[model samples]
Target chain A: MFKSSRFPIYYKGHPRMFVKDKPIFWWALKWVHARFIIRELTSVPVAFYAIILILQIRALSLGPEAYANFTNWLKTPLSLSLHVISFLFVIYHSVTWFNLAPKAIVIRIGKNRIPGLVITGLNYVAWAIFSVAIAWLFLNLDNLM
Target chain B: MKKSSEPFWWALFGAGGVISALFIPVILFIQGLAIPLGWIESPNYQHLYQLFGSPVTRLFLLALISLSLLHWAHRFRFTLYDGLQVKHLNVLIAIFCYGGAILGSLAAGYYLWLI
Candidate 1:
């Protein structure tokens, strides 16, 4: 678990002011700021994947030729790099999302709080169902379209 | 602060659920912008896509982004304050975290419009 630092002070009979070492060094300050920015930017890939999913669905609907062209374009080196970064983002997002899941939905039955792992398990089940539904629809598009 | 921390986690949990509920279903259903489920489609998904594509969707997106940003900002603000024992530059850090979300929401809005 991420936690704050606990500094001990051993002064008796008086209240002493407590403070951490100041960030007098510029490099250290810059490093701290950069770390926060990087973590926040990691969320970008989740946004990107969402956009790509939309585009891929649209392209597929257009035609097989268009879908092939779009996917081929997506497979290019630059696109691959973006996908790689986005994949990392997706993993991070999923983990954070899952870790945060139990708190999101709490089912209470007969005076017992639902387990967090149970919540996560249900989420995975839902995602599985959703993925299958989408795949099924797309696979049968020829007949349905 | 410690006493209130318990409820903070609960709030965070509720916020996360709200975010997922709004995002996931749309993602699962959106057949690549082609299968407009609700308003854009026939009676099958009518009123649904309309709900998502309408100004209301934009509003919800804005709210989600804004609220989530604030939620994230608050989490990070304390992370810095407590984890790093940051005290001197508290205001500056607060501004960056919350301001980043404000700016981010604006960007999301622009993209939403472009799309």
Candidate 2:
């Protein structure tokens, strides 16, 4: 729903063109832009989590003690809070991304155009399947390992 | 200018965005909420190391890291343009953003592959 502002002519049909320049914080004023700004902000945590994953890999490479310490460090209140916040942000990002997919992709079987909700629903289904698979892996880690 | 390669980058951004959106959150839930908060035991380090060492895991991690970085780059570029109203530095901004993603991705690959 993020949209550009519909700027009005400040001076009515002036011979010298007059433009109404919006403030930099204009995005905060509109609901759509506000959502858009939050979406853009989600990239920070996405990038952070990516780096965290890399660090996990690196800690693993360093061997058991390092990995244990890293894991322990992550359990701290500050880290947990950040994780929860980032998790919320990432989930929001995913839901919005799925919802927006219909805009980017269009499928037509003969004459009937597939509904956007159907497309979004299919994505959610796939996501649910994957989440379960990962959960299964996590739960069975003891046996698998 | 010839037709801007905006669509091409957008496709990459889209792919990255979708992949990260679907995968990252669940992992975050487990690591952030489950394991750390005592909802579940911590994962075995050796097993995790073995997983990380595997070719498939490496490939998945690489894709996750690189593509997500590219996604960030593309989004950040537009955020700067439309949100900040800084339209004059088009070529410079494009290069900086895309270049950073490429460089970060390469670094991720190198570290993941070498160590």
Candidate 3:
């Protein structure tokens, strides 16, 4: 499609329809490609949640009143629903990305390579560790009120 | 047809993708889910403020927000090109996407500093 157009007058005798390149939205053609596109789209919500975190920081700077207001905003049904959707999309992003870990990193043990499931499972294992550590820290914060 | 500097942005994209996948989800679960749903009590504002006061926290926050922005920039650039079929304004799109990310990162840093 980027090339300069080349054309012939249907070979001068028998007119034939010319095939064009797939439209830009070609991702719709397959489930794999569509899911890939959806993965790409997750960046929007990821950045969005980051913005909210930054806002939380700003509110933190302002003292409890501002933070309380931010919490109040978040407690609204609309904000809660948005967070739920964002959480789901974030999970989708994580699952797809983690699933691709095996492809991105080939683990070789001398002569034999690690099985794909083991490689992929390692990602989940690491995830579980980090998450549990964070959960423990978050849950056991003695100073939390 | 020519060699492009896409790999640089892509490196940032990949780093950001991994960071978000590994770390952001749990934070989302905590702030976006647990706190709101009362599965966990909201930590006192002072406690969180103290958490953010550390230089380490500031730096970690910097990495998280900056990489995520750059990730968005790179992805949004391709999204425009492929999804919307914007063929002619390539350079402008790159400038807008990456530049916007840079600006947003700086803003995040500034706010983080204030925090």
Candidate 4:
């Protein structure tokens, strides 16, 4: 598409003009491409969470004793290996989740992209509040039991 | 089936949404029942496993996994074509993407059923 604009060019790949001919737009385009790759790679955590969800279901279906057994085993060295891997996966999932939140929910002032980082940051803030509330509720529940 | 006017990826995305939304809720419901109601003395809460327990839930989960993976596969196919300078292999990539999704979904279903 960039090539279509009819601009007069005398030399085709002449070594003398090479340095001067390179446009700023080329560098900016490459930078944007790299950013897309970064975004895609980081989103692997989203897929990883789906696998984790399946694993949790399997553990539960095995019965209460099996569930306890699984939990106990999870504390062991071998199980800890998987846990460590899953921990990394969970972090990735959370990061991607927050990243996507901005796209899924539009926050606009007349007309705007809403600034992606600002949208992502607000998601983290909301999660923090939710976490505190849940922790408080869980602690109270534990006391009752 | 309709392979001319529309691309296969669109179908996969629609299928995935239908599958995941249907299965995840059912799985949640079955598992949620385990929470004590104070009425039953010894409730089998563990039976309410996520999306893996009941036959019906398993079917939906399998469908979800298949459709979703396929949908993403289609997405990645387009990504490869547009982003990676792989436009020449677009047709091959699209087929592979759909095939992989179907295979993945089937594998998920099989594994869930076996246990």
For each candidate, what's the DockQ?
0.11, 0.59, 0.60, 0.11
Off by over 4 Å in 4: A1-145, B1-8, B14-51
Best by DockQ: 3
Tell me the tens digit of each residue's lDDT in model 1 across A1-145: 2222356343454357443444433234577665555544544443454445445434544555765677567546687566555555544555556666797678999999999999887767775675566556444544453
Query: Per-residue lDDT of B1-115 in model 1, one digit per residue for the tens?
Result: 3465546644743463345333534443343232432223322222333334468655765565545555556566666664455667788997896677567656666645543
Error of 3 at A58 (Å): 1.2
After superposing candidate 1 on the true structure, give the runs of residues whose Cα lies further than 4 Å from its correct spot.
A1-82, A103-105, A130-145, B1-72, B79-86, B110-115
Error of 2 at A82 (Å): 1.9
Please provide, for model 3 over A1-145, each residue's C-alpha lDDT reduced to its tens digit, 9 standing for 90 to 100. 3421244323334357454455667888899888878888998878888788788888888889998999998888988888888888888988988999888888789999999899788888988888887776677654543
Using lDDT as the measure, which candidate wins?
2
Candidate 2 lDDT by residue in tens digits, B1-115: 7997889999989888988988898888997789988888865776767667789878998999888888888998898887887777878999998898898788778768854
TM-score leaderboard ranking:
2, 3, 1, 4
TM-score of 1: 0.48
Please, what is the whole-model Cα lDDT of each candidate in the order they appear? 0.53, 0.83, 0.82, 0.50
Better of 3 and 4 by TM-score: 3
What is the TM-score of each predicted model, taking all chains together?
Answer: 0.48, 0.87, 0.86, 0.44
Candidate 4 docking class: incorrect
Task: Name every residue pair that clashes in candidate 4.
Answer: none
After superposition, candidate 3 runs with Cα above 4 Å error: A1-21, A107-114, B1-3
Task: Give every collision pair in model 3.
Answer: none
